[model samples]
Target: MPETPPITKPRRRDLTLLGLAVLLAIGLVVVLVVRQGGSDPEASSSPASAMSAPSAAEASATAPIGPLGDLARRQADDPMALGSPTAPVVLIEFADFRCPFCAQFGRDTKPVLIDRYVNKGVLRIEWRDMPIFGPESMSAARAARAAAAQGRFWEFVTAVYDKAPARGRATLTTEALRGFAATAGVPDLARFDVDAASVDFDDAINADLQEAQSLGIPSTPAFSLNGEPVLGAQPTDVFTAMIDNLAAGGPANS
Candidate 1:
């Protein structure tokens, strides 16, 4: 078993944010008890250090709103999003295709979340590409965006994660990605391949990377729930509790 490290707050850089950057930073106090596993593949299955989670009172006292809350795009037709646009909660995830912890969350925890909250119109989930695992992961993100254009983004994402190894990068070569795209039912593989190889998704993917950097996110599988920063792939109960608290009209800092 990989050793759990000491609890550390999210890194706060002495920098200014403007416009879209502000959407990912202001009021998003980095108070997450995340694992180090996602940042280092060798520690892939290491459990989260939830023993360091803040007390309920401490958590409530700092519940943020305002700019933090506005992080939810709620766009009516975002291809990479799940659930109703107006859902009470929005879960924004920053992840890399080659990160094991990210794949674990996708394979294990996310489905439960989808069943419990997303399906009920109580929550929405948006994906952000943080391809920090290098070239193959970048390729996967690009392919994912291309898949999105065919209205198969989520399917493509799930398929890639499902096929990925639990301890290393998935083979995301042009041929492999196209195969995955075909499996995901992307109607036009010819166009999908072209788009993936093009620079069409660079700006959007770079925006997500910059967003994560602005937040000082140091790992994959980082998340924001209606602006509440959650650092790792915690248990399903952890997510449900947060959603339940918000769903019941709990207090928040405006």
Candidate 2:
């Protein structure tokens, strides 16, 4: 038999045709399989998973409502209400009394804010003593609580902060704090002094300090407006925006 002729090379056109046929078959199979199932990725997701995904509104609503949100909503709504019981927002101020920023807030920005918003009954400002500035701070906080018992808390606080030394010193010697109480028109100075030294007052300040530590408040002049915690002496606009947002019945931004 004659030697078998060398196998002829497959025609380029035939190879190309074969490759196209294979690709077409694969594409058809893919199309058929996709059609058998739901073609949309969104449609393919299980209902439970779909439900777990947050909507934009839901995502935006996760702002820090603070540890006291429910309590604040129920008991203290006014953000700046000094004595008003009907205010709609409450501002929980955590202060060390000896922090310069606290002094600045109390002396400058606070007055303006108080006169403009607090006095108008849009907010209720409630002070909580952190006393991180040491013994003097604890003393001042105790005295402040004593004043509160006599309904002169705001006055005593205002006087102490207003006259705070430039170097962030707020001496709270028994006599000095008493002097502040007197200037703030606190009657029964002797009674105030006794109350300040009482175990009750010390316990109250200690409790506030413990709570502040638990809440991770690292500095003075921190605040929670409507139970949304805000750190540092943020600008007036921050407070205004929160008040405005809450008033609008919208959750605050994180």
Candidate 3:
């Protein structure tokens, strides 16, 4: 019979130290998230009709309206401000950061859309948040607002979803949330913290929810190309076709 292998006590100690290091790293990440403020705990929905009618400021930036243009511009927040002002075709995405489907769409199809259209100045994408996933979801929404406060809304939005755990939940646990803000390239974490704790972003998030409700957007990853709604996590081809059609100045299909 082969001799029994000797027990390695020193190896066990080394392994224990390695485990401690990893745990410390995780704890640090959690700390960063909290300090930076990723989400809020006070978000809730409001009546869609409660959203004030458009003001003159909104009207001035809207696209040309006759029939089709009127329908398209109605849902658009800005006519000259698609994803980037230069893009002609506008893509409105009503999303929830905590929604697994929305994250998947962001990870899978959005990059392609950006690369093929946004980068090419053909498609302008606007992201609207519908924070319906509980308290933590509110935090996530607030974090985005904080980022936008520093002119990094899209960057922060992308980072939050990207850093979310495999379960796709934003815990808003202070540390976890701050980690996201740091990654989003926000320069003023302190101010962001104060903003996160305030009611500044409440109206914005509520307004977005109202907008979605106005458009009958009951679920997430709901997309629109020039006012035609597309429900569910659709394939890239579907988006491509809609975008192409919009770019051609064709009437949108409901």
Best by TM-score: 1
Candidates 1 and 2 compared by lDDT, better number: 1
Q: lDDT ranking from best to worst? A: 1, 2, 3
Q: Give the per-residue lDDT of model 1 (tens digit) for 1-254.
A: 99978545432232332454775664353322133434334344444424222232233333334244446666668999998876777789999988888888999989989999899977789999999988888898999999999899999988888898877667788899998899999999999989999888999999999988987889989888767778888877778888877766673222
Q: On residues 18-135, what C-alpha lDDT tens digit does candidate 2 reach at each position? A: 9999999999999999886754466457785455433312322433344555223222332222624444566778887678778877777677667766678655566677888788
Q: How far is candidate 3 from the true structure (C-alpha RMSD, Å)?
A: 23.5
Candidate 3, 1-254: lDDT as tens digits: 99988759998899999999999999999999886563322222434423433331243233322221222333344422235544556677888878877877877898899888888867777767788888878887887777777877777767766765666565666676677778878899998888777778799789888988887778887877665778888988888877776666665431
Count of residue pairs whose backbone atoms collide, per candidate = 0, 14, 15
What's the distance in Å from true for residue 68, model 2?
6.3
Query: lDDT of each model, Cα atoms only?
Result: 0.78, 0.70, 0.69
Best candidate, lDDT: 1
Off by over 4 Å in 1: 1-69, 251-254
Q: Where does candidate 2 have its weakest 10-residue lDDT segment?
A: 71-80
Which segments of model 3 are wrong by more than 4 Å?
1-82, 165-168, 252-254
